[model samples]
Target: MSKIIALSGTKNGVISIRKINEPYGPGSGTVASVGISLSGESENPEWKVHIPLDNLDEVIKALSELK
Candidate 1:
């Protein structure tokens, strides 16, 4: 008799991108990356996206492409 094994694909996670106010206050001229937890699993995945605080348009474009 032969045994069959199941195959599965695992995902490391996804990088979540979102808008946020200026870190210092509410101005602009800065770029930052932060890790966001996506899954509700015990080991919350760590993800981040590079966004220009000055130009949100670029961020929007990148997000659109992702979709």
Candidate 2:
């Protein structure tokens, strides 16, 4: 099983952020960064941003500007 951490929305509450931790083999893999977008229609598909674990800081900065 993988681990995920959710991020809060800004503004009134539109989008959310999620951090994915995927384990593969004996520490031979890495974790991924993903974003769950909820700003579209109720039936709209969620967007996934595949980012390397090393760019976690970038994700945080991007999420901070969301509303």
Candidate 3:
């Protein structure tokens, strides 16, 4: 599954969030993949980070504290 976030002040810019399995290959487990693209290319973003599923909650909490 995936979700997209449009960015303001930039044409076609977006952030994508997706769930990926074995992104690093078999036995790598799953991750919450977050990507940013200034060209609206969710499949090939300019920047990305993969957060292990187990760390999702703490990551969310930390991000929330930044808000």
Candidate 4:
């Protein structure tokens, strides 16, 4: 797994994009995932979104289509 990017939020938090293992087993067909995670203080829960490596291209395209 590799990290694509890491950025600090203006308010208070850390955001990162990384390559991670697929949540399901390897047999699930997707071996890797490009995901986003946001981490904050102990009082706040973190959030994450993991896009399968295979679907990354489409996902990126769709998001980029937005303003």
TM-score of each model, in listed order: 0.31, 0.34, 0.94, 0.53
What Cα-based lDDT does every candidate model obtain?
0.46, 0.48, 0.96, 0.53
lDDT of 3 by residue, 1-67 (tens): 9999997889999999999999999999799999999999988999999999999999999999999
Off by over 4 Å in 4: 1-10, 22-45
In terms of TM-score, the best-performing candidate is 3
How close to the true structure is residue 29 of candidate 1, measured as C-alpha lDDT?
Answer: 42
Model 2: runs farther than 4 Å from truth? 1-29, 33-47
How does residue 52 of candidate 2 score in lDDT?
66
Poorest lDDT segment (10 consecutive residues) of candidate 2: 10-19
RMSD of 4: 4.5
The runs of at least 3 residues in candidate 3 whose Cα sits more than 4 Å from the true structure, single-residue gaps closed, are none
Kindly list the per-residue Cα lDDT of model 4 for residues 1-67, writing each as its tens digit: 4443444553445454545454577765443333333543322326556677788888889989995
User: What's the lDDT for residue 26 in model 4?
Assistant: 70
Error of 3 at 36 (Å): 0.4
Q: What's the candidate order when arranged by decreasing lDDT?
A: 3, 4, 2, 1
Error of 2 at 27 (Å): 8.9
Q: What is the C-alpha RMSD of each candidate to the true structure, in Å?
A: 12.6, 6.8, 0.8, 4.5
